[model samples]
Target: MQIIMSGLIMGCIYGLAALGLVLIYKTTMVVNFAQGEMAMLTTFISFGLLTKYNFSYFVSFTGALIVSLILGAVIYAVFMNRVQAADHLNQIVITLGLFLIINGVAGLLWGHQPESFPTPFSDKVIPIGSALITRNDIFIFIFTLLLMGVLYVLFNFTKIGLAMRASAQDLTASRLMGIKVPLVFMSTWAIGTVLGSVAGMMTAPLTFLSPTMMFDILIMAFASAVLGGFVYMPGVIIGGLIIGVFGNVVSYYYSPEMKVVYTFLLIIIILYIRPQGIFGGKQTVKKV
Candidate 1:
């Protein structure tokens, strides 16, 4: 039971990581391959603030978020905005370049070693009947759920959210309707970066801070996003939880090393069966 609980906590973190991917894909129709690197970089920022300046968690978190948002905006202004008629391949190449740059920068700044991170929750474990859960696990689960709820409300009830949705659906139409399309695009990237940074901070305590931490988790998060449907929030969350639980079950039943292999296989099977994703509807392509 403790193991199951641990998997669920980890799944929530993956879901948060995938949420950033979904946000970017939904709005821009571009998969930012650099997302993992962005998370890693922001986490390093938090670590620097905490270790060098001895800043509080909240302060460091805020600073990291701000820096990440600025980075996201700059990436868009410098690269994404210039891709006027570029294909998906071009966008992917650009993002991949960003990924290498960020990864290299992180390694240069922090070295290739793992660093300890302070957790807001106590390390003590509490027992509920036969099941034992740590405060950190509970904190991660609750924090992720809270963030999801906030995002749900923002996308469902806010005007800006509606504009974003409109832009995603039809950018030219939305622009013609007087919406600030570029701003909406920038906002989407900003939100994605902020969420990614938060996921990084939350995960650092569990996984330890390393230059390559996001590299491994990024694959799982992408699988989660694909399994859930690129634009479906609820589906993404459920997919993440399923992957987390399933991976752990596999690990327990077999070797722990097979977890990633099983996850990728599961993703491939799901894609083969439902290419639009479990929650995604088939999009009709208009005849040109």
Candidate 2:
């Protein structure tokens, strides 16, 4: 029960990050390799606001998310928009460039030292049966769920969400129907970045804050996205939970060092068996 509960909490973190990745992929048809770095950068910014400037946690958190939103929009407008008509490989290269740039910038600014992140959550422990859980763990779980719920409501019930969905489905058709494709694209990036920022904020407290903090988590998040079906939303959530549980169980029974290796192997095997992913719909190839 302890391992399972811990896995579920960690799964929510992975799921949140993967959700951001899914959003960008769904709308722009581009995998943002810089997703983790972007989150890390904003997290550092939040840390500065909290410690250096002596701001409240709420203010720091909201400020970081807003900055992430703007940064995402700026990247899309100034870089991605120019390369919008390029091949997919070109877009990917651009994001890879961003990954390197952001990582280096973060290291230079933050000095590559790891620091403990401050959290508003209490450190109190709660006992459930034979398992012990931290208050922060429960807080993380609820916060992630609330974020997911907001996204669901936005995507399913709002006009902007409809436009976003339509834009993702068919860019030209959506434009023909009076949807502003560019704006939709920008908004998608903004929202994705905001999600990533939230993931980063939640994550920093568990792990120490550092420039490279998000690297391993990013890998797990990518695996989660692949397992859940890159284009499907709910699948991402389920996939994250599966990964969390699998990794914890492996660490418990086997070598902790081998856990990541086994996790990747499991993902590869599952993909080989079901190319479309567990919950992913069958792909339709268009004949031109």
Most accurate candidate by lDDT: 2
Clashing pairs in model 2? none
Question: Candidates' TM-scores?
Answer: 0.96, 0.97
lDDT of 2 by residue, 1-288 (tens): 998898888888888899999999998888999999999999999999999999999999999999999999999998889888899999999999999999999888888989999988688889988888898888888988888899999999998899999988888899999999899999999999888888889899999899999997899899999999988988998898899889999999998788789999999999999998878998776666
Best prediction by TM-score: 2
For residues 115-229, write the lDDT of model 1, one tens digit per residue: 8888876789999777888887887888888989999898989988999899988877998999998788888888898888888888899888998888767888898898998
The true-versus-predicted C-alpha distance at residue 260 of model 2, in Å, is 1.5
List of clashing residue pairs for candidate 1: none
Error of 1 at 254 (Å): 0.8
lDDT of each: 0.87, 0.91
Model 1: worst 10 consecutive residues (lDDT sum): 77-86
Candidate 1 versus truth, CA RMSD in Å, comes to: 1.3
* Candidate 1 TM-score over all chains jointly: 0.96
